[model samples]
Target: MLTHFERSLVEALRPLPDHRLTAIVEVARLSPPERREVFDKFGNAGYPILYQEHFANLRDIGPWLFCSGKYTSLQGQYNFHHGLSKATGDTPISWLTSALEPSRLARHLGEAATASGPDGSTHLLRFYNEQAFPILHSRQDLPGIDHLLVPIHSWWLRDAELDRDDGEKGWRRYEGKDRADCCGVPPIHLDQACWDALTGDGSSQRLADLLGSLPGAPAIESYYPNWLAQVRSLLAKGRRLGLKQQADLDEFVLFLSLHANPLRGSAKLEAAFNAAFKDAVDGNQPLAQALKQRLPPRLLTSQSNV
Candidate 1:
């Protein structure tokens, strides 16, 4: 089934009469048959953005570029974009219009498949992955990354974390700046700024501040000297369970604070709370409000426990 981003991508990629057409399809997560269909339709001439030079044998699983000429009608849209994003939990194929030939474009992108890290370590940069692309785009002065798409006439990428023009929560777009001729790779490295955006490098300091800022941070006050780590562990669990918002995360911190190490101190209560948490997130209701049935009223209102 088509996702919410599929139509928006198709509409956005529809180029002007003079514009070019090409898109990146991630085939690694796709089933074997799905991968075959793409190759069969496009042939072996398709360019891969990630390559063996940087990715080694795993390059086969990377994204492929194809000319999407017949993307006018809905069926044509299906033909060009059709099921291209079938791979589960992967970013959708991104669109780019470049005046350069396919080979030159491929060469330019392949250069970015790898990056150097501090202490002389080399790491693969998933530059083409729209999911990670936002991280790279979030900051300025990111070595080669800031202008990686300079050669392309126009580049459009999708990010699921952002708000869309439509009322619904779906995809967001980031257009490339510095549209100049490709000047080869600029030694894209895991710089300090890039690392922070990529991995939340200074998260401990931020989390500590958050713990102090919100009264609901820890379900209980800590006698433990390593309270930050304890709260960190609690927040980690909450994140895995879909608690992304600051308020929801703080409330979850408060809830799990009382649950103890085994979580709720019993399997049965844990199960009950799990169901309630899921319901609250899915229904867009306040988490603490929903937990009223699952948790005792006195406990919810009590002072932070030690």
Candidate 2:
């Protein structure tokens, strides 16, 4: 009892290579009732089959996908929790709902594109899922064949305290000074150039060179603006106006001044950090009050702010 769109999507997927189809079947092995719910909820819309790829050996800190399209924007990178859930095999339907929701997807893409590194590299890998796979696969003129479902995995090497040199050939472990940990501390020591390369165009090539020179897998971290951090802190700690907090507030005010449309920017920023604010104010009246104080008077009084 599929709709026309659903039927079209299924027909598209029917011709996929056996391996690719098998993977989809494995991930989507829902019960009949659950299948009906999924079909009913998502019948009209396309689904985003998420994918991830690392630059250099930075593990999971690379760009990700929310859908498979030639023009997939950088903002399509999977959120932290979504990536973590996918990595750990805990993906829920709610997670999928949030990801595929059009408004939420647009907001996320906007934030990611705006906050991208200096090179402005917002392009991400594209992949096929049940919804998109059929459409893309049907096109005979698709540019790349290997752009299909290729799984990626990452592992971090840990330091071992003991070095055991077994007598077997190629079986030697180093210990003490001789034993070096394969995984070192996070790559918090990235120079400005490195940061530029990571966030810039051709980031993958840059990452490969960087990782080639490093001893262990580099741990990548997300960058947040100072004002955003301050707002977040105020929301979390409640109305504690220390010198640092005051400075953060001042910076936030400066940010507002710089933007031509402060209201729009504020709304986008709120959407970007929605999860954090939700966590901070959950069952915490003091934190909520602190957040209210930090917000502009206009925002507080404006019904359009929401």
Q: lDDT (0-100) at residue 48 of candidate 1?
A: 72
Residue 206 local lDDT, model 1:
56
Candidate 1 ranges with C-alpha deviation above 4 Å: 1-15, 52-56, 69-79, 83-91, 153-158, 161-169, 178-180, 200-306
- Return the TM-score for candidate 2, rounded to 2 decimals: 0.16
Best model number under lDDT = 1
| Location of the lowest summed lDDT over 10 successive residues in candidate 2 | 152-161
lDDT of 1 by residue, 38-83 (tens): 6776645577777657365676788767664435444554555554
- For every model shown, what is its TM-score relative to the native structure? 0.54, 0.16
Candidate 1 deviation (Cα RMSD):
13.7
Estimate every model's Cα lDDT from 0 to 1: 0.57, 0.27
